[model samples]
Target chain A: MSDSRPVFFVSDHTGITAELIGKSLLSQFPGQAFTFVSLPFIDSQEKAEIAVRRIEAERARSHLRPLVISTLAEPELRHLIAQTDSLFLDIFPCFLQALETELGCPATPALGLAHGMSDAGQYRARMDAVNYALAADDGLATERYGQADLILVGVSRSGKTPTSLYMAMQYGLRVANYPLTPEDLERTELPECLRTYRSKLRGLSLSAERLAQIRAERRPDSRYASLPNCQAELQAAERMLRAAQIPIIETTQRSVEEIAALLKQSLATA
Target chain B: MSDSRPVFFVSDHTGITAELIGKSLLSQFPGQAFTFVSLPFIDSQEKAEIAVRRIEAERARSHLRPLVISTLAEPELRHLIAQTDSLFLDIFPCFLQALETELGCPATPALGLAHGMSDAGQYRARMDAVNYALAADDGLATERYGQADLILVGVSRSGKTPTSLYMAMQYGLRVANYPLTPEDLERTELPECLRTYRSKLRGLSLSAERLAQIRAERRPDSRYASLPNCQAELQAAERMLRAAQIPIIETTQRSVEEIAALLKQSLATA
Candidate 1:
């Protein structure tokens, strides 16, 4: 009976915050199959009511009350969505009310401000960080290595690119990544560029099985995709990283968000 | 007196979900400074107690009740954080209880599952999307034009790169961007490659003044960065896009997050 339950993430803006919060809750219920639908830009009473009707229809079809997670800021619209038959969780209002009490003032309840251009300078800075990440990706731009906030080293397909990009896109960190080639692994020491940036160096490691699986997707049945090859490269790289006293994070079980957060934490304390 | 309030985002994992929800709420209260700190990886009662102590110390330092937003999954850890000196807003417990009531089962309190690699396929898909975005960026690889989920066209420095990268990084969308050079702008029709992929084309425009300001940061005192030159390029690009009937989004006052959300919305309905 726990199959194909409908879940809706509603928001007046991007619905990303709603989705992130809802996913955290939904992930707790692992066995159930949930179909996620995002209803973004629900700023008006009309849109809110329409979302309610859709949820109702979905509930009627599935014989299960759909879970609705929303971050609606407008009071009237929020109230309308809350009255729906779905199991509603409006993320912002209760928190905002508590925040008003703690701060001793009513919140402004600004719509679309969570992920909007309220601060132009921050927006531009994030864009600049993205460009910096792209330009310095895969050790292509060593000239800007001095400006890097993080330098990730790992074998190919060990998740250096996506983690670097995520760190840049999400937290606006200037991240550069270098892939550990066979030559670099044979040296038994860190690369010269990485040595100068030791303060910023972070290593990403993955299990041999996961590395082989990922590499196989890129190049099927090749020597690079062989499990033995993956094991050798990973073991060598990890040993090199440990010998050089560089911190290593295993990326097999962790998501890119988690890796980026750990990187940020290390940077802050380093 | 509404200055420098302390805020803590506590979570059993990376704290991203807590921070997103908290930021959405705090963005409503502008013009007041808030010192935000994240306490991640608090999976144990000891770490949870340490976080409470930190929050209490911050509250004592600021003479203000700190606002704590958390998505802790463990019952005991959630309880420990909730009973802190700060005004607590735990995001998950009430919602999870409601979900359990609706689903007719108790939810599993899995730590660090929200953004973790619980589903390897989706994670790999996201990494593949990031690689695709990088490969096809700025009209570099046209052979894979058919594979793009979005084709963004804009004049130089019109906020295409970051938005494309965001769509790829956040939503796992394969976004490809092309710059509208002056030669293409002078024409009455869209470029041939774009015309083939017109259904996927999304145009981004900016206020000429803002565009000039952004361009000036890269190349000061150049004709390309001059206000008049930017005004001309933007006008021609806008005219060409309009002639081709491509949907346009103004990036002058929109963050990359906003632009990516709008882009995803358009793609969903298109």
Candidate 2:
């Protein structure tokens, strides 16, 4: 049964690419249930054989063949892992082979290059973006708003902080987040500090139920976590944002990845 | 020339996975240079047509055919994107089709699900981890160290904060980072607060030159950014970590992604 089968994401590098591609692929198969285990840094022949043994043990225990999705670059190691009694899917070779043919140059594939320090400038930018995101979080560093690529505004726990951090880290964008306090929401205008940077402003909106649920996790039995309070704050925030012509992104069900992607798209167009 | 060819990561979702895979594949061909662009949320026919035209425009301007790497789900949209005059490489359909064949189920693919909120528990864990990392930054919240899945220790700008945030955001690991100042380096033993949770410790080390360069960007022409001081601090930090039997990862030319991967591996083993 699909329920009994497990999935292993094997890679010679971080196993991140393998995991991402595998997750997207498996999400297409919603009817099945599977447990996932990631085995990273399996670069050597010995480690590859050990991975094979682990796959075999898992298969024998579950009485079903497991799915092995790998990003292994070394041919010898990939061969060793592919010999196991499972459905082995190696991602790079087929695509890279086609790319090599098109580009008319053989690829010198190596481990640790996927997420390594290949582009020093981009690497530095990502690190700086993370620091900027931290330093300018929650309206503390509104003075540095001029350097911001985007400023995310929302009520508390509406996902401004996480989305800000994700955009900074993933896209290397200088992102700053400002929380719209109840006092600011009470006013019919946007915060004074955010007015000059209106071009960089984006609003995040969350459903009252989800807001209350998330707030309850942080502060239970408080006025802050009450449903009516959340609803009022959200309504005021949306009203102020729409009046100012700042676009609002509803983030009740979207992940930080989706939010960051939409932000990047908007930044490019703007 | 190879430098003229451009690469486009086209996707219906976040385009993160497509970019990651494309970068790794292109990194193998380091002898060449290429420009990279990501076109996300290309889910509809109109957007797909726009992306194709953009690719075509880039190719025409550069006098070199561009590479289009996509994670599009719908066959119709994929066909539209593939008809572009370039090397079109669609990742998910190939792998997902094979997986569907293996599972004996017809795949019902959809958009916006790759990095979407599929598992609520995981989404919550990732959010909590990001908050934990921020709260515990620079040993600010020592009392909360009890809940940390891992603790990173290093000198200033030795790649502690970014790595901690990345581990939290990517893997949902509650990571705390402690910086060893000169005062702590002058002593022969570890800091009093860190003494109790030595088992959860991991050290990050950077080359003195790299450390100085990074610090100089923050505080120029100061003793804190001096190379000699950096060398002394790194030496003392490495010695203390070795004495405490904490594994040190040298991140001279590595990125935060690599550092976090190594930490995850160490955690799995430890």
Candidate 3:
């Protein structure tokens, strides 16, 4: 049976947790097909009407009601959405109502703080390092490179950006990354911005074949994506990093979480 | 009392579980200043050495032995870490050693792959969405704006990037975002990109004062960071969006997660 169901996640803040929970719940119904979308930070009545209209349109198109999982705190918006034909799972209202009834008092406005904290200074320092590595221009990053707690260097498509951003967001670390261009490989020297902050620098190496495959997706039939070029770059970059005494992490087989954790450990140690 | 301590989190493949266990164990020591670091996917001898050196350095600097919590699968790395001058707590080793004496099998490779598959897709999708959102460029994003599973448009510093990335990472959705710049506001019309993708666009509107506060942090004492300018931009942008029949979400007091959740719900219902 073909199922043309749409699933929507609406939130008043970062919808990440709700999306995860919704997806996990949806997984229980194996073989079910659905199109998923997220509408983040819905706070006004006018926006609520737009969301309601979209649900109405989807219901008319598919001849089946969509499912909405929301965690919005605004009562009027929730009421507006309820008018739609969709099946609604309002996270905040359901949970808060139950909690309020049980406690015999109106639910207190709960401030959703991040689950954990890292040292603010250390986190900022790490972020600075990542920013230095990824900064568009070299001159500005150079003066500030030394302030970074950890800097990541890798060839393009080496999973540097996501890894750096993950470190910054999850750990509140300032992370900077620089893509090692062919010029840098030919010179067999670190980027000038990276030299003074050698102690903070860490190299992210990927398998040459995997690197080529990833690069091929973005820029097909390019010299940079060639197997031989990839191999040469990998070898030269590793040799340069090794000679400079900069630590290296092979990210080809590792997940983002693994790489971030490894980077964190390296930073703490350094 | 200047008490400095190094905190550590060690894990094998299941870092989340290890983090939980380690946090629980670490709670026993109260009133001690510490730094928490996760050491995930430490599968090899070389990687183990990298972790050990970090622990050793932390121990030396703080004059307090570092806390080493591990679920290292390899016996050799377990032995190597044990030799370090720190408080070593190897969860897997302790459990395996105890269980081996009691049970027949060594329990090296535990069974129940069923538990592994439970939330794998959700986790993967979330990670992919996050990566995609971060890598999306303004121009490319504009072209595919209507095809987006969700779209976020906002004034500068209204928390669009983080929210969009969070949605993608947490829900595995293609999220496209466009910033409603000052020029667009003055014209009293949505950008051409947003105009084409009106149906998919969801606005993130923050209080003008709040927007100014956020922008001030990034570019202090600039015209872009002025409260009056932010107020004007927000008003003009909202008016333009309303005239075009687009939806807007106010993000004045909401958290990122909350915003994302609301967005997900809206899309799911839509």
Candidate 4:
């Protein structure tokens, strides 16, 4: 089957939490198919009623109990959505109650605050970090490197740009990535600019075969995309980073989110 | 009172679901101080034991129960972390059991599958989308716009680039953004390239004050950053978009996540 099990990620804010948790749960029952819909900005009774109707209509059409994972924060709206006879999974009500009991205060049930412009400072920082990632990508031998929270170094297609952008976008990290050139790999010593910011450096390492596959997408059949060239560059880059005591992340089989999370955890533990 | 409350988001995979849910729950309780850490890649018994020890150490130092929100998939690791005796929030266990009973099948438990390279096709699509966003940014009247899934059109600093990149990175959408210059805003008709792709156009709308503030960060004291210029350009652009029946997203008070989700919902419903 396809995405046709009629899954709804209902929430008061952006519905991101509902989507994340719902998807995680569904991934476990891999072969079971479900069509997911995220109805964000459902911050009102009217919208909640609409969501209930949508779910009801799905139940009528599919002749099956639809699945709903709701992160609705308001008690009233939560009850309204729960009125649906579908297999309702109220994602956050019990947890919020537990948290409130622990914190010794009731949660403030405000709308659109969980992941929106309510925190202007954090929002601006993330935007600024995205701008920094765009500006500081590739060979930037400039003073702007000083402002970076971290610098990623790797040979081409070793997963620098996407990782830098992901860290910046998700974690508000000012990440700059410098691609290790063939000349930089040839040199016995580490690049001069990178040496100055050695403490902020993290190396991204990937297998030569994977690197060639990626490079082939851009410059196919060229010597730069050759397996031998990729092997040599990766070997030299790894040796240089190891010699300088820079921690390296093997990104051959990891997604951007995985790379960013592992790297963030390393920074936190370090 | 800052990031010092010793909150741990432990997971067997990327920890993103744990982080997103944990942060959402924490955000509900305002003014409660906490420093959160995401310890991803916790797939082994050794890592689970280390996490327990870390939580125990935090409990010893803070003299308060540390908050732990774990998404560990393995039942054994989950049991191991449960021994910590802190204010543990095992985020997924209860939900997973409920889902299993609902689906009439036992979940095939595994580590590091929620958000990683386990689905290589989706991962490659996201990377390709990011590359597409980079290649198709700005007034790209090029033939490459034909390949775009969606095209965002707005005045400078009205939030086209960030939205494009965010959509590309998060939702794996090939988003291409086109900046409307003074000349395009002055014209009665939409720009030639944009007119052809009117069906895919999304307008990002924001107040003049916010636009001026954002532009000031890039080009301070310039006419482009002046309030009047911002006001005039936004007015003309909004009118032009309305004439063409393009949906405008007011991004002045919305995060990138919210905007992307809302846009996605519109697409799904449409």
Candidate 5:
């Protein structure tokens, strides 16, 4: 019988690279049962204990050993997981040790920049680019909006947040977004805050029908969720964006993949 | 002069895979000018045309041939992009053709499977696993959730929606998440909605301090954004999750990659 149990992934940063690397590694073992979990950041011993206990319980139920992949495995975390009778793989420690042996430097604090330009580095860059793109001038994001690689503007539920994040994680672009409010539509002008960064601005527009569907889920009976209201808002927003010469992409029916690709293509050529 | 322009990535789903694949491909050409733009989905031809026009304008300024990579290459989109004097690579068609040749079977429409698992047999198995995980009655997310290969959950601002999408595009996991709301905290119970799925339910918790910081940025002086309220909500939520015996992870102080890794580990062991 296949080992059909699951594995867990805990990390202190983007768990994606590790997940991909882990999955690629596991694909080599077919018919083996596995489970996967991703813990974002375990900076505290208490949280680590909670994670360890959960892993142990899963192991007991599945009757299989669990594998853990992580970058922030403090001693306390290790101790907690060690109590569980499961195989643990701490990726960063092993990587650090290997790098230390090669470079004669202690691996106390992992030096991210020391690693040469790698695929991972490129990924980070892409993430930065998307983060830059999503940032708006309203002091809403982690980084400064002026430094954004691109800016997205749209009405609520037009898929701005997800799109902006996708840009960040996938391509390392710094992205920011501003929701076009009713006031902005009525004024028929871009938000005053967006003017300084107008050159980098891009717009996301969704069909009124689609926007209504999305908003209805969040606010079932509000005028904001009605199709006619959505249509009016969308029309006004589009006109304002066009007057500002901001490029727009409609997200009514396309998949997220398609939208990201289209934006990337447009931005690349731009 | 070195081509040092930033790369952009936008996506409706997780943009990680495209960023990774794009970066991998770009690495083959050193010191090349490149930018990645990921737009999650473009539902309207008019919006696509606007994107194309922006690309043209950018290309005119850069004075170099641009490279465009996209998953969607419908004829209209292709025509719009063709107007730009740049090289375009439509990834999905090529990917689909390659898969068709590899699997020696015709692809057909199927719902709820990863794009990579286009093969009918594998797709069916994956769909079954996902549906089973979703339909699980226990709060434990179960091996099915572990089998999910991807899962996401969090409070409103902990960034679960974006992160789940990033995982799906990058790792092709059938991801799902259930929010930990104030009601859930008050009851100190995992959503009866998630009970049967306990084993598969990984928790996403952000630091109370971080949650306050994030909330403050959005709703500066509201009680919900107050430090005390943030702390209380976080404590209550964490306690509820713990009492319910669910696995929990904090999402503060980590990048997207780290989160993806932790989830991958959990899924592997699940």
Candidate 6:
């Protein structure tokens, strides 16, 4: 009996690039159950044989040809992997050749260089941004508010922390988020520090029902997680955002990537 | 003169997939100062027109043709964007057609569906992993040790936290990390609790010089940040990991993505 649940992402490096591309493509066909198998750092012929055997075994057992999404840079390794008894989708060779033609220059086939520590400065900046986000989370690092590239404010569970962390990790953007508490919402205006950085402020909001459900998971059946309380808090937060005249985004139906990308676009335009 | 610093990642949806691919490709060409502009959610003809105008303006001002890496799904929008004077690399069309040919199926042109909140279960699981990572950071949530998918042990600044977060965010893996304190390193045997879950443990180690440099940035010249102290701590941690017979990877020259992928591979194989 063949199991049709395993999907392979193989690469000579971290396999992240291949996984991202593979996952995006697989997501379009969403009904199938997928068990993602990441085989990274496959830089040798021996390792490539192991991967081929694994894929073959999966194919033999499942009665379905397993899909292998590969980003291997070396021609010989890629050729070897392509010989597996499965549907192979090598992501790099096609695009790399086309890009070489477009640029009229041969690309340096560098292995393990896609996401390595080649740029120490950029790595440090990213780490620093991550630390800043952790410190400034939930209005804790108020003194460093001025250093923030963007200040996101919203009610709890509005998807602020993840957005901030995504921005920091992906773009090295220094993001600080403050949760809108009852005291802050009681007053009709934004916080004083937020006012000073008003131009850089972003707001996130979600559906009251969704907010209540999320909070219920954390603290069940309390006033803090009640639907009525969610409604009132959201109403106050929306009113404060309107009073401030800042750009607000709804996270009810959007993913964290969408929210972060929207914020990045606004920052570029501003 | 057109500005050469701006690089645009254009997409009809979240633009994250395009940005990831573009950033990975661009990082190969080091020494170029690049400013990234993400133009996401361009679902309408009017919005596409706005994006074209923005690209043209950048091209006209900078005197250099701007590079536009796009992931637009709609044919009309992709065709419209390719008409711009700038150099364009549409990431989806080139591969989608090939994939369609390979799969013997026509892909529906679905806009904004790649990274949306369509799978509530998967989204919730990812978020739960994130919350779990945060709660279990620095040995804080010891009660949930049995629930962890992987336990990472390392000295401070050995790249445990970010790796844990990346695993949770990218792959929805519940990761808990414990810093090997001096007290723990002074002991001969593994911690009592860790011994129970030794099969699920992964270790991280880094070069003493690099570790010292990273610590010096956070806390300057103190005993905890001193080179000798870092050397001794790392030596002790490495020995303990060896004595415990758990797998360990060095983070001295690798990115968080690489470390996480290595661990993921180990998990899959185990």
Task: Give the best candidate by lDDT.
Answer: 2
Evaluated with DockQ, which candidate comes out highest?
1
Q: Kindly give the stretch of ten consecutive residues in candidate 6 chain B with the minimal lDDT sum.
A: B25-34
Pick out the ten consecutive residues of candidate 6 chain A with the lowest summed lDDT: A95-104
Error of 5 at A238 (Å): 1.5
lDDT by residue (tens digit), candidate 6, A1-270: 434467799989988888887877766554455677878888999999998888888878775567888888888999998998777887766566655564456766678576776777887788788888888988888889989999999999898988888888877899999999989999999988788999889999999999999999999999999999999999999999998898899989888878888898889788
* Regions of model 2 farther than 4 Å from truth: A1-3, B1-3, B56-62
- Which ranges of candidate 4 are over 4 A from the true structure? A1-4, B1-4
- How much DockQ does model 5 earn? 0.08
Question: Which has the greatest TM-score?
Answer: 4
In model 5, state the lDDT of residue A190. Answer: 74
Residue B85 lDDT in candidate 2? 87
Error of 5 at B146 (Å): 17
Is candidate 2 or 5 superior in lDDT? Answer: 2
For each candidate in the order shown, give its overall lDDT on alpha carbons: 0.86, 0.90, 0.66, 0.86, 0.59, 0.84
Q: Tens digit of lDDT per residue, candidate 6, span B1-270?
A: 323456788888888888878777766555455677878888889999999998889877775567788888788998888899866877766556665665556666677576777777887788889889889988788779999999999999899998988888888899999998999989978877788899999999999999998898889978998999999998888898998898999888888878888898889888
Using lDDT as the measure, name the better of candidate 2 and candidate 3.
2
lDDT of 3 by residue, A1-270 (tens): 575678777764455444543553454344456687766556678877777887888888875568777766667777888777776765444334433342234643322222212233543453343344345222235566555556778777787777776666556576667778888888877777788878878899989998898789778999989999999988988998998999999887666666777788777668
Relative to the true interface, what fraction of contacts does candidate 2 keep?
0.85
Error of 5 at A18 (Å): 14
lDDT string for model 4 (B116-198, tens) is 77678987899999989988988664578888888998998888888889999988999999998998988968888877887
Rank by DockQ, descending?
A: 1, 4, 2, 6, 3, 5
Off by over 4 Å in 3: A1-112, A115-140, B1-10, B14-135, B138-141
Measured over all alpha carbons after superposition, the RMSD of each candidate to the real structure, in angstroms, is 2.1, 2.1, 10.0, 1.9, 12.7, 2.3
State chain A's TM-score for model 4: 0.95
Q: lDDT by residue for model 2 over A197-270, one digit each (tens)?
A: 99999999989999999999999979999999999999999999999999999898899999899888888888
TM-score of 4: 0.96
